[model samples]
Target: MNYQLSLTVAICFGLLVLLGYFLPDFDLLILLRAEILRWAAILSGVAMFVGIISLLKVHFNKFMDQKSNWGYSLVLVLTFLITFGAGVFSFIFPQAEGLVDFMFRYVQVPVESTLAALLAVLLLVAGMRMVRYRRDWTTWLFLAISLIMLIGLVTIEAPIPDVFPFLRDWLLTVPVVAGARGILIGLALGAIITGLRIFTGADQPYGE
Candidate 1:
């Protein structure tokens, strides 16, 4: 009985939202949709805050307990505190904007750049390992494509023919765009399927 009521409520709200989107002439639906969406946004923000607090608590406990690798957790806690403190100060006193910007540039930017570099290095190492073990055309092709892309990224003119640069541009513009669109299409289809499942009661959320 409770499950049926929950399913009925879900279907009603789902229809209200879909109708509000498709039929903007219905003022009541538009208002209901706006209120529902606003509540969702508020809930999302609260959830995010809870998650951050939970993360800090976990790391603080790990550090205080003096577990293995506690030093890393200590570093993380200190970094978070410093960053958060700086952000709060900057927000309270607009004159301290420079302090926030400095931390972002010196700390965050370098960390992100290092991660990106590690990703490239890891990918190269993985490709080499695959080629060594497999010794197949596909592995060789993968390595060749990676090399060509890296060479294309260089601003300096290489000793090789001009065709490499053209090939790189074509690959970026054509295959990359096509692949990105395909991923978006897949995501949209998945979302649609999920909505249908919810509406049809195939996926029950409020069940005990």
Candidate 2:
């Protein structure tokens, strides 16, 4: 009974949202869709809050138990508490908003940048390993392009190849844009399929 009720509501809401998109002149469908979307956003916020509480609970317990790799758990707990505290404090007193900004600028941004650097290094290492094992033209091409991009970052007096900057720009503007568009097309198709499946009751991800 509960599953049927949930399925009916989901399908109806999905149809309404679709209708609102297709029939922009209909104020009734537009209003209902807007309200539905707002409620969905509220529910999403609640879900995120629940996830944060669960994450903290698990990490705090691990830290207290002093389990293997507990140091990472400790860092996560302390960082979360400090960030959350600052956010709450700023919410109460807008003048102290700089506390939150400092946490992001000094801590969060650096951490993210460090992770990005490490990811680039890892990708280069992986490319090198692939070259050793495969010895393919594609692998060599990838390595060559990567090298070009890295060299473009250096503070050299002039481009070594004289066309290094142009080549790098062409690579970024052409291949990267094409690849990104392909990915977006795939995502749009997948979203449409997901919506269709939900409308047809082909997928009941809500429950069994």
Per-model TM-score versus the true fold:
0.73, 0.79
Per-residue lDDT tens digits for candidate 2, residues 34-76, read 9999999999999999999999999999999999999999999
The TM-score of candidate 1 is: 0.73
Clashes of each: 0, 0
Q: Name the best candidate (by TM-score).
A: 2
Q: How does each model score on lDDT?
A: 0.89, 0.90
Candidate 1 CA-lDDT value: 0.89
Candidate 2 local distance difference test against the native: 0.90
